[model samples]
Target chain A: LAKTTQPISMDSYEGQEVNITCSHNNIATNDYITWYQQFPSQGPRFIIQGYKTKVTNEVASLFIPADRKSSTLSLPRVSLSDTAVYYCLVVENDMRFGAGTRLTVKP
Target chain B: GAGVSQSPSNKVTEKGKDVELRCDPISGHTALYWYRQSLGQGLEFLIYFQGNSAPDKSGLPSDRFSAERTGGSVSTLTIQRTQQEDSAVYLCASSLTPRGGPSYEQYFGPGTRLTVT
Candidate 1:
């Protein structure tokens, strides 16, 4: 498992775009970058995943640089309901979660 | 379709007691995982079961913690001699498969909140 580092917290307003970055300097070749969102009293939900380059889905977009040392999660037109804790994980088999980045979407 | 379901959403027990938490994974999912989440903290992996293969128990914190998946569909995490430090939310997740790839997306249950007094 690769250790990940992310901001402790972030703040944004409604209808704004929020981007959270995660750093995994020692990522392995087989490791994939996955993002999950967790709301109050709920389990984390998968948002997006990527091995390299960029991957986009109905909810969010994941951008992995060429070096694969870091990745970014882009959320467009965020709303108050988007407030949650975002986790960036680099996993091969075992999934180890870090403290995560808390995004507070204000109204 | 149901994602994942856990039983006994909340449990309060005394120290030195034993407790069991159950998890029902999505139909046909081959990979099931157990995790522990403390208040204001991140998730800690506990155990994993993939199909009929031997479960990976390396993440278990102690001998008191044990889990078993029967028929590859349901799982139960048992803790013996629970202590106050065992008070936390226990979560269960399932995925289509356990292969290390981008397609492995884990669906989590609401979790069981255990409070050991």
Candidate 2:
């Protein structure tokens, strides 16, 4: 399993865009970059996933550089409800998690 | 459609005793997983079951922690001689298939909060 590193926490105001980056220097070829959002007292929900380049969804966007050593999760038009823990995982078969980036969106 | 569901949303047990947590995955899902999350901590993978294959138990913390998936739908995680450290939220997730591709998404249940006193 590849180890992932992300910021401990991030703060953003409403209507702002929040970008969280994760570093996985030892990512494998078969590993895919996936992001999950976890609110307090709830299970993590899938936000977006990508193998390389860019992938966007109704909720967020995932940017994986050519090197694939790092990936970024971009959230547009942030709101207070967007406050949650964002986890970036690089996995193929074994799905492990790291200390996720806690995003606090203020009104 | 109904999402994943877990039983005994909250449980309080005494130390040195045993406890069981149950999970019901989504219908037609062939992959199920168990994870543990301590307060303010990230999820820790416990085990995984894919199709009829042998479960992947490499992530289980100890021999005392065991899980079984019967009929490939319902799963139970059992902890023997539970200690205070065993207190945490047990989460269960299921996906349509195992590593089909980058599109695979794991749907999670609300989880079971266990407190060992």
State the lDDT at B89 in candidate 1. Answer: 99
Q: Identify the runs in model 1 with alpha carbons over 4 angstroms from their true place.
A: none
Q: Provide the lDDT at B9 for model 2.
A: 100
> lDDT score, residue A33, model 2?
87
Stretches off by above 4 angstroms in model 2 are none
Q: TM-score for model 2?
A: 0.98
**Individual DockQ of the candidates?**
0.83, 0.74
* Local distance difference test, candidate 2: 0.94
- Note the B-chain TM-score for every model: 0.98, 0.98
Candidate 1, residues B1-111: lDDT per residue as tens digits?
998999889999999999999999999999999999999999999999999999999899999999999998999999999999999999999999785786879999999
**What is the per-residue lDDT of model 1 for residues A2-70, given as tens digits with 9 covering 90 to 100?**
799999999999999999999999999989999999998999999989999999999999999999999
DockQ of 2: 0.74
